[model samples]
Target chain A: MRLNLGLKTLSIFTALLLVAACETAPTETGDSSGGGATTQTSGSGSTTTVVTETKTTTVQPGSQEDLVLNVGDRVFFGFDKYDLSDEAQATLQRQAAWLKANPTVTLLIEGNCDERGTREYNLALGERRATAVKNYLVTLGVSADRLSTISYGKERPVALGHNEAAWAQNRRSVSVVN
Target chain B: MIGSVQKIRTLLAGLVLAIALASVARAELVIDITQGNIEPMPIAVTDFYADNEATAKIGKQMADVIRADLERSGLFVPIDPRAYLQQPKDLQVTPVFANWRKIAAQALSTGLVRALGDGQINVQFRLWDVFAEQYLTGIQFTTPPSNWRLTAHLIADAIYKRLTGEDGYFSTRVVYVSESGPADRRIKRLAIMDQDGENHQFLTSGNELVLTPRYSPTQQVLTYLSYFNNKPRVYLYNLDTGQQEILGEFPGMTFAPRFSPSGNQVVMSMAQDGNSEIYLMDLRTREMKRLTNHPGIDTAPSFSPDGTQITFESDRGGRQQIYIMDADGSNVRRISFGSGNYGTPVWSPRGDLIAFTKLTGGKFSIGVMRTDGSQERILTEGFHNEGPTWAPNGRVLMFFRQIPGKNDGRSDKVSLWSIDLTGYNEREVITPGDGSDPAWSPPYNLNR
Candidate 1:
């Protein structure tokens, strides 16, 4: 588990570099000064040169780290509500596309809830949340056979705070590649 | 594993003598506990008389245990021994009524412990009405010396039942979830202790998450939910043998399990895909019956004492509410029409009231209503309270209350508390650390 988190962090770093690469020139000069390269972006009749290290560590596609870093592995819900928001659906769309590309990878959708609800009711609510994600993915052409669900029901929490910020993070459904 | 003492062996020594003494009694003293508020009866307890030093020490400990038991019930206040005018040795014949009355004691309890030469001892106790100047009742227990604590509880139970006209809950055990660590990654283990929080033992290691443990009718078995090997499922445990097993074969998560009153069946919820439905499994035959076939979530099923009806919380009516149906999944009707969401509706053992947790206005309250869903009374309310379990007598309810965490929620704490059915005498049941989801066992059989 610790190793996975570290790798997730590393892939997130790699993703930031790719985003930076998009803002700069598409091509990098092979000549480097002190292990750095300069890229020029030309637009609006002006040219700007940006200096940075142009190095990237490629993460294996269709892997758990790839899902976390690129397509988003989880989506949040409102307090005591399981209906998917537009943002959650957008994330699920990317996840569905990713799953289509990696057909052999089975996904475990874990439904979770904030600690505000009772244990049993939250169990039901969490299941609904997970099912909402699964149903949406199915509409996006992901097979039902490749997707399974479980509700943590506030038992497993990602954020441990009493305020809304933590609760919003805790109430989510994460798609785990198994 | 400290509460491994052998079961008690009872020998009623003073039954004939106490009955003979009761024949000449007048103006019997009694406590009416059904009222909302009443003064606690003042009772005097003396150390049990013993000859040897070792036996005398046990006698004194027994006296202290009995006094604590009676005091915790909130029906009696055991007087200070320093104010007692009669010593242990002086109570061999009878308690001087004048000395006890001068101290304003309404009742007196005295006992004697004698070793019977085989690592066994005979503990005898008697309750006396001070103002009436008459003997009330007496009993004797023959058991190993290590069972002195149980002997004291038995004496307290006898005194309580004799005065209050209700069974005493002293000799019972409580199985609960002992929690520790932080809020996001809490460690919960199954733990059992005496009603007074003695003999604390953790039934399961905290390696996995466990919750909502319910005791069987036999008191030797429990059914709870566990996240074993990351497969959330219902599991059964045998107290005597320390054996655990999954309750059923399910493709998804199975939780909110409770044993039937007959101890031969279990009713629980199995969540597959996104729908949760209630089901009943016969323990003997392993036959599973689907009780509710709705798309809405239905869980937290508890059976009425008679086993003719089952009460559960469901969202079939658009939101979480308490509902009751026949034992065979017929005549389903919604019983809760309160202001907020209701869940965890536990049927009272007396078949009269149902206890539940209600969330209203962003707060949680423990309340009870009649079987017909009338006379709804909120016993206690706070920032967060859930899961109310009744004592066997149905006159008290124990629930867990969580103190909301400050800042990061790392300071979050949960503890077990009990309140009278009359909504009085709310006291915290002290545990080694934090506790939750307490289930009270039925009154133990002294002979067992």
Candidate 2:
């Protein structure tokens, strides 16, 4: 009887996952375009254009430098897995080159997880994910002293929806210049 | 033979008197509350009478706090004061039992407050078993008027103990992480409030992020994880002196901190080179002892009530599960084999069960099981619910629940909630803002 109940739950979960995948597939493209349009509008306006350009170039405190590096600052991971994928390794390679160019810059790596698991274990997993990225950057000739890692567990999420797309985006490690 | 017959007659008389006394005592309605319906007992709390005009206003306020405390517990249903057939004046004279019994009240409480000068007030209360037609218990307290709320809690505790045969957790406080702003750029700070969400105060400004504030067993000291100076380390904050200091200077990130039962040491998890392990630090000598030497993650260590054993979560068994070991980190044994992963195993103060957060089939739940992983029971299931903290009495649990965001992905709200041990009386504990990671303090006297 218990085995039958377990099988029933598994079928229902699979059905829900299929529906979520279909719904999120089209929205993923729309999100990137929407973000692009906003950035373009700010860049074209005469008054705001100067502010936006200086904000990215000045490297001020608390500023996000993802635009200047010409690469995404975050790399995604598979479910419950911390081993860096080929794509993650490529992103770290670019991040390593950028850090080498800006020798005075120090970066903090933040590891985060989705909202599907336990808090404390997710925290530990996040730490592993962040450290995995940091160790790769070291292999690429980035100074170990210039990198620090912290895990926010499932506390901080860039995507708040409860779907595969959101979860995929939430399970990531981001490098922030300090 | 004649002398033996006289002795037998005397012994029979003595036995008969003992039986009569026992029957009389049982007639006072020794309520069998070990098991019953989830329905709360109907109770009536009459307004306290004041001797002076100044104290008359405070008297009503005291009754309000007491009513709120009992109602929040979900064990006693305070009847509406408008349905009260009796007035405050009725407490001065013997309460007419017929008046209360007519309203279907199982129990009745009455009190008197008098100004003792020098900002001190004398409070006295009496609890009556209306059904049994007898007085249960009565006590008096003389304290400063500023402590009127505490004085009310004392009376409620006395009634709760006499009727339920269990200690009350009304006068306790909770330390938790207060969160605000958006999900991506959130601010969390350490905040403390009364168990009923009164007298809310922030211990840290929202300058840096903070998480998991746990009170020590000895004093008003708290151990929590903070991102101060860009280092995520465990720090201690003294509530009385308003001083803060880091517990140790480790080469890696330190998190998941908890105090030992004796409050003489701190046990936490530190991550280095992509692996996390549990470590213990003595507060007196500042000595550090590494507990678990595994490459897999081992965190969230909680000591048993007697401080002899430790319970924690580890992924060494190919998945996250609960484990137990001795205080010196020997004889490690796995205690959880449920379907999904288990984390954050907190041993009950009663030392019988361990509460944990379980994840299965895309849902998170709060559950409890015996120390040997038998008789597992999941209490609450939701889209997102974790972090179970036991009430001081071990009869209740408090945790946080998060609602999934809307289509725009911007409507997520987290709130603190509690439920009884029997899986009934689930209630939402209102807070000033989004809250998580609630830790209940030990009973007030236990701290001393």
Number of the top-ranking candidate, with DockQ as the measure: 1
Off by over 4 Å in 1: A1-58, B1-22
Number of colliding residue pairs in model 1: 0
Individual DockQ of the candidates? 0.30, 0.29
The residue ranges of model 2 lying beyond 4 angstroms of the native Cα positions read A1-26, A29-68, A97-105, B1-36, B407-409, B446-448
lDDT of candidate 2 over A72-109, digit per residue (tens) = 46788888889899988987887887787778888878
Q: Which digits, one per residue and each the tens of the lDDT, describe model 2 over residues B287-351?
A: 88989989889999999989999999999989999999998988899999989889989999889
Q: Which candidate has the highest lDDT of all?
A: 1
Q: DockQ for the candidate 1 complex? A: 0.30
Tens-place lDDT digits, model 1, residues B213-247 = 99998658999999887678999999989999998
Global local distance difference test of model 2 = 0.77
For residue B422, model 2's alpha carbon misses the true position, in angstroms, by 0.9
Candidate 2 DockQ, CA atoms: 0.29
